[model samples]
Target: MFDDLISLCLTGSPPALPQDWWLRWSLAPATLLPLLGLLAWLLARRRRPLPLVGWALLALALASPLCRLAATLAAAHMVQLMLLLAGMGLLVLASPPRAHMPRPGPAAAVHGALLWLWHWPPLYAAVLGHAGLHVLALALLLGSAWWFWRAVLLAPPPWRGTALLALLATMAHTGLLGALLTFAGEPLYAAPGARAWGLEPLHDQQLAGLLMWVLGALGYLLAAVALALRWFAPGHPVRRATPAH
Candidate 1:
């Protein structure tokens, strides 16, 4: 059992992990840590609301390195995405005694530029290929949004709010940003020097950009509705002053 846990957490091997395998293996522990906490909370108190920090932690998982592998392998991406949603979904469902505890909710005032940063604009420089980072960022953004949608429904207040907002923003940002591609006179990502994804270089990147914007629009519409549900719910922490009749 110990060996299996190690394998699952470190390299999916019987302990002979390759250098790249270590990354996925490393992620499993961080993802499982919350489950450990949830287990402890459940054992201590059979029934009680989960803390808000737990929800925050969950959002972090969906958006960051936790799903890094998912962005690399199409098949692995689907599997990891499901695992992410399931893990976080179950944790939120129980709402263990230690959860639903809030920690530094959304800022009182929002900045347009910071909001832009949250979109995490393409570095446009670090990319080994002009379009590599852009393509990669889209994969991360869209994949996380899809997986987190299920988790959002199962998440606690304010968390659901933040997740929903992030989802909405990602969609919008991708849309506006993707415009650069759709309108560029020539293909930027599949040029002679650009990296190729088994296609004519830049072909995949151009298509990817179109899909990113189109999908982003769809996510925005769906997430907006989800946010509305939270807005209407009584006592939702993210809700602002109720509009007067």
Candidate 2:
């Protein structure tokens, strides 16, 4: 039964039939148990709607049919990553304000490094083939993203400029990676399953790259713009108070 459960959790190969796509939900105990615990905690404490919504999005990305699709399609995998990052960002934004968060510069650097490391073709291919490695990769990605978001969002007003710079730097690196993938002459990922979905491997890779280049960078871009606007707004924490006549 344990082996059966493990087999059930494995995404296996891509679905060849259209109906199989919608039916393939990953009810992994490793994923579902923690999500259930989180849900109970959220309900018990009566958390705000934003965190709840974020939790739902996280569940959708990890436990829904999307998880199975991600195993086969690079583009679907990109969507899952984006959803996880966005969900983590929302959760951070809704959390109670705290002091002494890590500096955005170091956090951004670590997150960017991890992002690049995971995208290395050989490593990524291996991860997709092994469920344990795939989970570990996602855990590390989400952990770093959480740290980066917290650093940027919770930094003191005086450090907002630094945060903004870090955010833009992240955006730049991710966009550059995406551009590289998009323009590569051949398929970077060995996704033979893409043919089952009527997509050439190169085309699938390019689509994934486009999603990362545009959609992935969008979150950071919006955050950077907001931070800049707040920095220059009247009476902001970083702004000097004007003297009365």
Candidate 3:
């Protein structure tokens, strides 16, 4: 029985089209079992609906046809990465973990570094070709991003300003990376079957860059603006303490 399941988990070659992309979902036990366990844990703890929603996003990124699509198209891979990062942000915001990091700056830096490192052309190509490296890249990317979001979201009131700066910094770095990819004269990363999907390799990379630049910056910018609003609201504790003159 376990052998049968393991056989289904093999990392197959990239799918060629006119293959039905929607039907190319991954059935890897290694991915599915852990996600199921996490879902059970979330239910047992009775976490809020938001966290459950976040978990569903993570599951969709890993188990749906998007996973197989990522193997063939750079744009699809960027979408998968964005889904994972967005899900991690949602998870941390809804149910923040115990804050061990006293400041958001370092966490943000680490997270940004990991994001840039994985997207470096050589490393990106190598990781895409090897299953183990791909898994490791995902783990590092998600874990660091979660830590960064948690630190920013749960910072003490005194640190809120710094947290806002951290968010902006993240937005800047990711946007810069995206712009580089978008404006490059040639494709820096390889996509095995991009042409089959009507995208040349350079076009695929540019689309991915646009997704990261616009969508990634938007997520962090929205969070920063929300935090700023909360800090400045008239009913905030700091503002409410002003003496009645």
Give the backbone clash total of model 3: 0
Q: How far is 223's C-alpha from truth in model 3 (Å)?
A: 1.3
Stretches of model 2 off by over 4 angstroms after superposition: 1-17, 44-47, 236-245
Q: How does residue 206 of candidate 1 score in lDDT?
A: 52
Winner by lDDT between candidate 3 and candidate 1:
3
Q: List model 3 lDDT by residue over 41-148, tens digit each.
A: 778778678778888889888877777777677788889888888888777756544424447888899999999999998888777667677778878998898888
Q: What is the C-alpha lDDT of each candidate?
A: 0.41, 0.78, 0.77
lDDT of 1: 0.41
Cα TM-score of candidate 3: 0.87
Candidate 1, residue 200: the lDDT equals: 44
Instruction: Report lDDT (Cα) of residue 36, candidate 1.
Output: 64
Q: Rank the candidates by lDDT, best first.
A: 2, 3, 1
The per-residue C-alpha lDDT of model 1 at residue 194 equals 22
Per-model TM-score, in order, reads 0.37, 0.87, 0.87
Error at 1, model 2, angstroms: 16
How many clashes does each candidate structure show, in the order listed?
Answer: 12, 0, 0
lDDT by residue (1-245, candidate 2, tens digit) is 11222233344654424557677666667768988997887777676787788888898887777776776778887888888888888778665545556788889999999999889998887777787887688789999988999888776666778889999999999999999989999998876568888899899999999999998889789988987787778876642322122
